[model samples]
Target chain A: MIGSWMTLPLVLVAAPPPPLDPDPRASPPAAAVEADPKAEVPPLPLRDARRAEQAPPPDVMRAADNPRVPKAKPGPPFYDAADEAVFRARFDLTKDPAPPPRTVRMRCLVADPLCGITVEVQALSAYALRAQQGSVATANARTWHSARAQYDVWVQFPAVVRTIGRTRFNVLSMGPKGGIVASDGGDLWANVGLAMRAFFGKGAFAPHLEVTGALAFRIGGFTEGGAGFFGAGRTDLGPVRSPVGFAMDIGVGLGGFGSLVIGGQYDSPLAREEVPESLRTPAAGMFYVGFRGNILWGAPAAAAVTTHVLAGRLVVPER
Target chain B: MRAGVRPLRGRAGVGYRVHAVVILPLASVLLVASLASPAAGSEAEAPPRTNRYLEAPPSSAPAGEDFGPFFTGPPASETSFVKAPRRGSGLAPRLSVRDGLFCFVEDAHCVASLLASTDVGIGMAIIGENGPDLPYAQLTFRGGFSLRPVTLYRKRYHPWALGLTASYSVGTGGIRLQAEDVVETARTQATRIALVNQLWLWHRPHAFHLDASIGAVRSGVLGRDERIHDLWGTHVELALGFGGWASLVVSGDFLDEDTRIVFGFRTHALAGVPVAGLTALGLWAGGVL
Candidate 1:
């Protein structure tokens, strides 16, 4: 009789009535849970669980988007603030969405072997950023190419001065200026020039080709016309003794701020008909030893902020 | 050769001579000292595939595409792409300060050639004559390009690399005349051209390197009254790269009328600060012990 009773309960469990509604969204009957409070709920399938995680409740989504809604309690972070800072610091500028900012500075320009200084305003044009808008993100991120145009004015003091032919001069003074035997004569000149700088590997270094057209004025001593600061006097008032010439110098310099530039300068025909035959210096070539100094100007801060935002947006939690 | 035009013997003076002597030995010592140390990047370990310029693709990089420091393709861009300039395309300039004895038969002068590397492996130099006659007398350009197809990283894939170099120079023919004094007939150009075959043996990331070039040259500049005097000669050079930034060079040109020997040191000046610092550090650490 007891066996018959157990069989009768098993038959009842097997012959349970079907659910009225066949929708997957319907909640499960609570009878089973009520009967066995300790029973574990079955886990969802991988695909369904992923879908559930991706698609939050409408109310929850709205609350998350609302600024006034209070945020959930804080959880443990995958990476520390220091790691994020490092990541931000190392972000490459070539990968930025915006075009890289150019550099501008006021520098002191002094070509050594010559005792003269000038203030110059220099601007460096950024390389064109050709981001593939429609391309894959990986492909867009891989393009790290760069180049720029570095332009500046070459201005000097005292005015332009005429130099002598066959008379060589050092950085300080001219041996003999325009046949006038001044003990120590200096050069007074100004130039407008352009430099094309091509960068290699993250713009840490570059090689540049610079060309300039210069106008040199004449300086006069008590007796004759010369070119110098003290030994020679002013002669810019006289009949256009200023010579127009051109110079080409190829060199390598470190950065926009401070650098050492060493190259050869070819000065082509300073004067021909203006000066006397004894003072005519058609062509002169000299070694260029230049130092560029950026004293007060600081680098642009936009790159850092852009990189920080980029790093934050791109950060992924550690697995 | 023209009259009243004399090649100034030891024209650079004693100060330049002293500087050349001091710099050469100091460079040698530094080179040897750096070579005795450990290689660079040993302290900071990198992931397998980080360096994009390596011959072999980094672990994370795509396979089968060409990658190197100097030899590579243009970047893929969705929009119109302006290709970036490559190295050795006259972008990274190499400057060498040469102080040597430029001799012709019995007469010799101390000359300085501030040579700058320019377009496509050619080095264009202005030979400055630190004399009473003229500031610069000649325009000399010479350089070599490697024939090897591969750009190796760290160490050279092959120890031997063959190259071809050409040298040409034009200047005054031992003549010291004012630019205005010389008429079109009195003006003369001294010209020299040579084709050299260079053999190089180097182990990069280390300091030891040796190269030898041999070639035939035609050098002359003997036209005073519109009379050209050109002659055939042989040119030879042997260079030893000691310091990571400098090299010791010994070159000779043997002609019928003018035979000369040049012994000098060549150093490099890089453009950027970070590059200079990193190169120094890398050379110091990666020096061959």
Candidate 2:
């Protein structure tokens, strides 16, 4: 009796069995057998199915709008459609064949020794295109690349100065109306030079030759009709005149890493001066020792201008 | 392999985060405490007292009859010259002891300078060396002139002064032995003199002074067989002054391609005394000179 009770509890805990299938030979109901074949089957859209299969993956489509997708993968930086379009236009990626060669034009303004401005242009032939297009045609075409050199010249203007030098004369008997007179005028002066430089190790040495010229004028007058004129002689003088003279100079500059320049210039006068027996004049062969230094505010050989201060002393050559 | 490496890195990251959290606050607290204590002490020592009469008595009263003459009445105005009434008179002689390390551009070794200045008047310095037994010893006599006269501190004209200095240095050094085997001992002596005529323009606000100097210098070096004379050169110096009258001067002297640097300190002491003291302590530290 206890075994029977346990079997009953076990049967209650188990699930019910599934129903058996109907036999094939069994007939169906009249209404179900009479259903139409056209109503039962739905038509498939072939074009839509094919298009869906050929489309890009869903992740790729999603990534087109998602920025985080690019950060997850290591590759070139991602660009939006507008940025990509701009880059494509700038680089001109659509061109099939090579474009014409580019023209390079250069212009320079050099100052030092002399002030000058220069412009250059040049034409370069496309070597590859020579097989397809004749040289004559390429030369005549305005669309071709070219470079040229032109407008090379130097312009210099004289620095003007007006100054007086010391005069020596003994004081003598003079009338109340006696006075001294002096005159000064402008002179044109210019210096022209060329330098060849060589740099080695930590030092730069340049050998240069320079030519200098000056146009000068001076006028002076002495007291006339002094008190002693009746007793002795009349004291009177006229203005003295002088002409311009050209000078030639040669020098070499020794420079180092720092903007240090030391040079010596020898100058020889092209003309001699005529002076009275009682007057003293400077000798012809006068040389000047010059030293210049620059503390450049920027990098060397750059376009930035440098400030340089120069000091010179003129030494008279021994007669 | 990946699983094992992952936990190690995770634990290391956690450890770093913990260390950062613990160290930052502790370091900040210590820094704040260190900076605040000195400021607090300075404030406590000079508390702002509203009772002018009671607070003024301790500093102004005479402890004895001799001190009675020293007490002048409260200054008539902020710019009044209560410290020293007379100008140009009651100028105290200054004595200074200076010591510092020095280097030269021409030499690899560094030397020390111990010197003193005895002031006969304003803008005058008499210096002599007293350091370790060096290769040379020098005696220098120097004097300077102020373009603007010295006035009492509070009544002084906008802290502007210009000056010129001239110095003469005489010294003797040991004979430098050459490679030659013969011991040729000669008079190891030299006389170096420099005349630095400068114009100094200075402007001051409170205890701070900014100064600039430009001048011409003439220096000469006389040796046994050679003499180098610099007829003319350029000198410039920029200086800053702080703490009432203590100043730091940085000077550069250019002679041809050579340059010299001079660094020094100037101090003014004994503020209320009749003869105030001026001291210059430091060195003409470096460069070719």
What TM-score does each model's chain B reach against the true chain B?
0.37, 0.31
lDDT of 1: 0.28
Clashing pairs in 2: A120-A148, A121-A147, A121-A148, A121-A149, A122-A146, A122-A147, A122-A148, A123-A146, A123-A147
Error of 1 at B7 (Å): 19
- Candidate of highest TM-score: 1
Stretches > 4 Å off in candidate 1: A1-319, B1-138, B149-156, B175-208, B221-226, B241-248, B263-289
- Residue A231 of model 2 has an lDDT of 14
lDDT of 2: 0.22
Relative to the true structure, candidate 2 reaches a TM of 0.19
Q: Candidate 2: lDDT of B171?
A: 22
Tell me the whole-model lDDT of each prediction, alpha carbons only.
Answer: 0.28, 0.22
Worst 10 residues of 1 chain B by lDDT: B101-110
lDDT string for model 1 (A80-104, tens) is 3344445456874223233322221
Q: How far in Å is the alpha carbon of A50 misplaced in model 2?
A: 95
**TM-score of every candidate's chain A:** 0.28, 0.19
